[model samples]
Target: MPDPNSFLYNNMIKGFVDIGSYEDALTFYFQMLNNVYNRCNPNNFTFPFVLKACSKLTAFEEGKVVHGQVLKLGFSSDVYVETSLVDMYGSCREVVYSKLLFDRMCKRDVVAWNAILASYTQCGVMECAKGLFEEMPVRNVSSWTTMIGGYIQIGDSKEALECFYKMQKHGMKPDKLTIMTVLSAVADLGSLEIGKRVHEYMDTNKIEIDGYVGTALIDMYSKCGNIQKARKVFDGIRSKNISCYNAMISCFGIHGLGDEALRVFREVERTRIGVDDVTMIAVLTACSHSGLVDMGCEIFNLMRKDYGIEPKMEHYGCMVDLLGREGRLDEAMGLIESIEPDIVLLGTLAFACRIHGNVELGEELARRMSELDPTNSGLLVLKSNLYAVEGRWKEAAGVRRLMMDKGIRKKPGTSWIEINNVVHEFVAGDASHSHSKKIYSKLLELSERMKLCIPTTQRCQV
Candidate 1:
């Protein structure tokens, strides 16, 4: 063992990398470097496995040192070692270095092409990724998924779906990862029809609804306003994991089905799935929306005491929201003050103040937030709305004036309706849409017709 040569050291490093013990792999790599008994050096085989380990860990500095060793040991032109170096640099987000090595290669294979392509995609350089993707003579499922995920990461869900459709048209069958990624794109767009299409495709293809796919389906259906279908998917899964249960609970929570969420939570407890931070957040959200302050408090206590999960920022946000919605502003404030200062938690209380017509509390929150972050236009809008809601028109106008002076404009409320798989977006108080004139005309007609249908006395009161 004291005089172990390169082969043994390489195998040991490869073992750790293969088992996903990346740090252990690097440790063995360093050990091989300091092999005092035989003065053994890492060969080309050792460098690739070592680089693979570095890639997974995103160990940029360690990878650089390995790269130096590769060059110093005259293994610089070795294809496997070069490819691994390319992948390592890519994973570390050093795209320039990755691209440099990739371009310097004498012959590029599918694996090499895919590695650089993934680097660009992972760094959100979609244009470069697309270019490289199209240039590659052979494209694999990973290539397509990388592009789709990159688009999704950049908030271009429509493009992501288009890429998935193109991927299908090219006779590339989607694996579970690709399906899950596409489902996420559908969820972001709230495209129920497309989500249903994906589900049907899975059924027709007989793809096993594993935990990843099941969780993705549940999330997609719930986001698309079909909680019943989401629950059906959850039920259909043969072996449900904590993720599936969390997604289902979140589905019900978002739809304000608090009781159903709680029932599912109890089922999770009964099944001994054991609650995590995510589970608590989902259940707390359900309670917050359904005005179940007492139940929320009980669950919050249960999370800390029974589950031994400390309250995260999200958990505290949910609790504050629940208590604030129930008009327990002081209680919410007291609880929040016990923790660190969080702008999101403060904003939650500010919203509650507006809802309950507590102008004093709202003003206090507004002042506090302004001091913390003057660039927060959303908080300014909330403060302004609070004033307007309580008939303080002068104060509301003053807030608006402050916004104008600071060159700040709040993002308008946006709503969307999908018809025949085409989504139409409406922005509040904005007439910039293509069909705005027609939409306004129809709205005016509806208003006149409603006025004519109402009795004169009732119309006056309205």
Candidate 2:
């Protein structure tokens, strides 16, 4: 035992990583390095396990030290070791480092290619990921799934669906992870038709609707405005996790079915499935959107009293929003003032003040916002609008002049619509669409027709 060799060190590291004890794994790797009496030189196997720990912990500095050892010990070109180094660097967000190691590899295996592909994808560089994906001699499910996930990460749901369908065209069957990633895209797009197709695919292939997938289905259906299907999927799941409950509660929340959300929360309490921070946030958000202020305040107290969970900034933000939405400006102000000032929480109250025509409080909030972030174009605009609403044209013009002097242009607002399964995205005053002329022509036609209806169409004016 005095001379624990490379084999012992590798096992120790692997065992710890398996149990999710990344810190312990690194500790053993260091111990093996410094073993005085019979110090063992790490072989090819030693580096991968050690590098894995570094990757999981995102310990970039520690991983760099391990890379030095790999180079010094002549295991730099070992396929497994090189791949692990690539993975470690990628996980640590050093895309350049991972690609450099990948480029230097003597023999490029699929695993090595996937590791680099993942690096680009994980960094949200989908263009590079796509180029690399096409160049690969072959790809497995992980490669395809990683690409799909990259598209989803950048909020390109249509592109994600295209990639998924292309994967099918390549005769590659999707694994569970791929399905889950695509479900998110469908949810975001609110593409009910495609979501139904995915559900059918799962049924045809007999894919189990396990905890994660069921939760995703619940979300997908809810977002797509099919709350009934979402509830059905929730009820059909044989066993439910806290996430499943949270999804169902959130689904009800989005639909403004506050009572239904409360029923699910009560069920979580009765079943004692254990409430975490996320559960509290979900329920509180439900209450906020549904205007259940009294219930929200009561449960907010339960965070520390019953759950032993200290309310964090997000919790306080939710309470502020809830109170603000109810036009309780004074109570909202007192609550936010009692905590450390958060610009977002303050903005929430400021917005409420503007909504309720509380110009005096809006002025105070404008001063606070400017103090917090002088360069915030949105706040500058908010302040100008608040002044204009109160007929303070001089002050409004002054605020606008300050914005121009600072060269701070307001960010353009954006919106999107889906037509024939294609999502068309547009920003304010955009005319870049391929069908822009046709779209505008049709809009003008509709506007002319709308005027013919006269005062009858007043409520539906373009």
Candidate 3:
């Protein structure tokens, strides 16, 4: 090799880091340090790429050595070098060290601020992130997007939406990343009205619906229960990628439109778009729900033999559900035994046993499940229901007493409904709504109407 301390070697290291060959970058960096002739030392330009490699590899020991080298070289005050060190520590999940480094900086810039802000966000300390965000001297689009993305990452979709609106109020136009992030939050919330407004804004601004944005719109519309709009968006995409097709297929699967999903799959095949594992899963799910057993079997076989896609556990689970729903208990049980045991798969089979009135198998499965999840009250409840259905009230009472003795209780189910761009949450049997009385009165009126209609139907039968 040429002199390891040469500028050529430095550029080569940078090239490797740029192309994501982090290990190669680190190798060159170490070779330069170990060189006996050591005439050329790493300058300000060299430390950032080496630090980036260490960060990418999470090599804390090497990173600490590099930090010492930077201090000895008297390049510690270089803004780029300091910013890179902060980013390196953050990426390695050593946020405290990153913060200490930041506090030691004699001057701060936007890049330095973003690095620490990202560190806090990445570590799931959003409260600290928000505090830093408020203290920032200057806010940019990146700053806003980071905060919004942090909320989304923590499953606080509501807060993400609020942040987006706040960004707009500050006269910041959202770029593609911001739009995609907010759309995802909108989908999770199922706020169709808000989603519609976002769509309208894009249209009014004449923003091009590229692949990423197009996929997000399709996903948002489909998840929000506006399938027609999803299809429209799908048609509008000039270049539909595999994800776009997958979204459309999944949309059909969720709506139980097996034929439509199959048709779309066929179209994908004709275009030679190369369907992936996700596509097969969607196909099998659709067939399962629509009771297309023979078609599902054909597709499953084709996926492995023709497409060379090995079936995952989820694929096996779908097949088990398909067979169980069709009352093919033996086949489902054999399939379950062939694979590793999973709680969800066992639960599905247990429920199927209850539905098909196979109390013996149900009891055995429930017993095995109890051993696996002894603290689960839902399993106990299922066992009790199974006994009660078979006229074994004594056993049912015993299961209930066991639950009481163990202090196990079922969690209340909660649901949400969106209206007028707002979401309302309710738990089972909850009467906390302001209009609870009016809601109950309307429900009673509907119940009385249904009761009167039932007697008229009996008179007609006579």
Candidate 4:
């Protein structure tokens, strides 16, 4: 056996990589490269760590140089080295390069297959991801998770659920990654029945729902429109991470309970949970929806002053909405002037201007919005409102005409009904069926009954 003391440096670097401290591993790698200590060839263990660091840092140029060195050093064909190169390229969104490396491998392993599958999934190649999953000689938990997550991204919740069932039937007991992937799929499907079943599975197996799994479950329930269930899972967890806090806050925001979301956010801050930019975004969005200008400003300032996170465009957009909703049109416009005006900020300002009867400013904002999104129906509709308010009926009609000429129509109003285990969506006058007559008769009867019970002026014309 190798003497332990003789391999101290190698062992130390391995420890760093194992714990995902890839940056530290690279520091050692460079030191060895410069002969700072006794020169050491990066063994199989060392190369993976270096590659991981390069992938994480998105140092594609460095990664290419490293790949060349691996080839020159006769480690190019090493399965581990090849797998890491594939991962590095995939992480960089160089899928073509990753595929080239994948094809060159003489012996393909489960990890190699999983890496390519995940590459396709992350790159938004859903069909390719599904094809790879079906073609893999051996599928691991990672492979299944990749396909499930890909389907979720494509908004094909039914396919994702089907893949989940198929994965289980293959006798693969899902680990934490698998559970997290399926939770998101179930969330997108908005199926509380499946979510409850997943909840039961976790309880029966006594799975430690503490980290990723806990956060995913909270997101699932929240997205399913069951904040109560999400809160229950959140409360049952023994320890919470920053992700858990972010998920719960997001849940509250989506449910229109912005105040409660802010309350949770404060508790998160008080408990010493690290608030990231994502956390700030969720809280800010909540404040915007609830028209909490002061709260939004305070949180935004805290994000910069305390957390040191620079406010990006999304943050500025939320602030504009918050201020605009409160009739602070001048303040919102001043903010846009002070910073880089994004489309969202401009649109919000336009909305405020329309509300406050400031046609000139509204028109200016509408021009900016049109530049950003040339044919946005919502923007044109708001501009038409401004024209209508100013007694420019012809201009308002011209705006609508322009919209029609551009093939952009107003989005129809939508309503949701959760029936059985699935959510059913309906639109007005969407009776393209043989029972249209009966449906219209029933609708008329209900309208008549409502009219009889209420005043004529209160009757719904639609």
Q: Kindly list the per-residue Cα lDDT of model 1 for residues 1-462, writing each as its tens digit.
A: 657888888899989888899999999999888876788888988998999998999999999999999999999888888889999999999999999999899978888888898899889999989888888999889888988999998889999999999999999999999999999999999989989999999999999998889999999999999988998899999999999999999999989999999999999999997789999999999999887789999999888679989989999999899999999999999988898857888999999998898999888988888888988999989988998887788989998999999899988888878889887778898898888999999999999999999999989745
Q: Can you give the lDDT of residue 399 in candidate 3? A: 93
lDDT, candidate 1, at 415: 80
lDDT of each: 0.91, 0.90, 0.87, 0.83
**How does each model score on TM-score?**
0.86, 0.86, 0.80, 0.84
Q: Which stretches of candidate 4 lie over 4 Å from their true place?
A: 1-32, 36-41, 354-357, 373-378, 385-393, 407-416, 426-462
Scored by lDDT, the top model is 1
Model 1 is weakest, by summed lDDT over 10 consecutive residues, at 1-10
Candidate 2 versus truth, CA RMSD in Å, comes to: 4.0
Which stretches of model 2 miss by more than 4 angstroms? 1-16, 19-46, 72-74, 401-407, 419-426, 431-462
Once fitted onto the true fold, the runs of candidate 3 whose alpha carbons sit more than 4 angstroms away are 1-98, 105-107, 391-409, 441-462
Candidate 1, which segments miss by more than 4 Å at Cα? 1-81, 430-434, 444-462
| Candidate 3: clashing residue pairs, number | 0
After the best TM-score superposition of candidate 4, give how far the Cα of residue 116 lies from its true spot, in angstroms. 1.4
lDDT of 4 at 98: 91
* lDDT (Cα, tens digit) per residue for candidate 2, span 1-462: 756787888898899999999999999988888885686778888888889999999999999999999989899889999999999999999999999999999999899999999899889998899899999998999999989988998888889999999999999999899999999999998888889999999999999998899999999999988999999999999889999999999999878888899999999999898988888888898999999999999999889989988998898888888998999999989988888977888888889888888989988988898898989888988898888778798999999999889899998998777678666787777899998889889989997887887776564422
Over 1-462, each residue of candidate 3 has an lDDT whose tens digit, in order, gives 565555877898999999999999989887777775856678898899999999899888889999999999999999999999998898888999999999999999998999889888877799999999999998888889889988988989999999999999999998888888899999988888899999999998877888789889988998889999998998999988888888888888888888988999898999898989999888888888888888988898778788889988888878888887898888888887887867777778888888887888888878888888888888998899889878898999999999999899888897789887779877777799998889789989987887777877675433
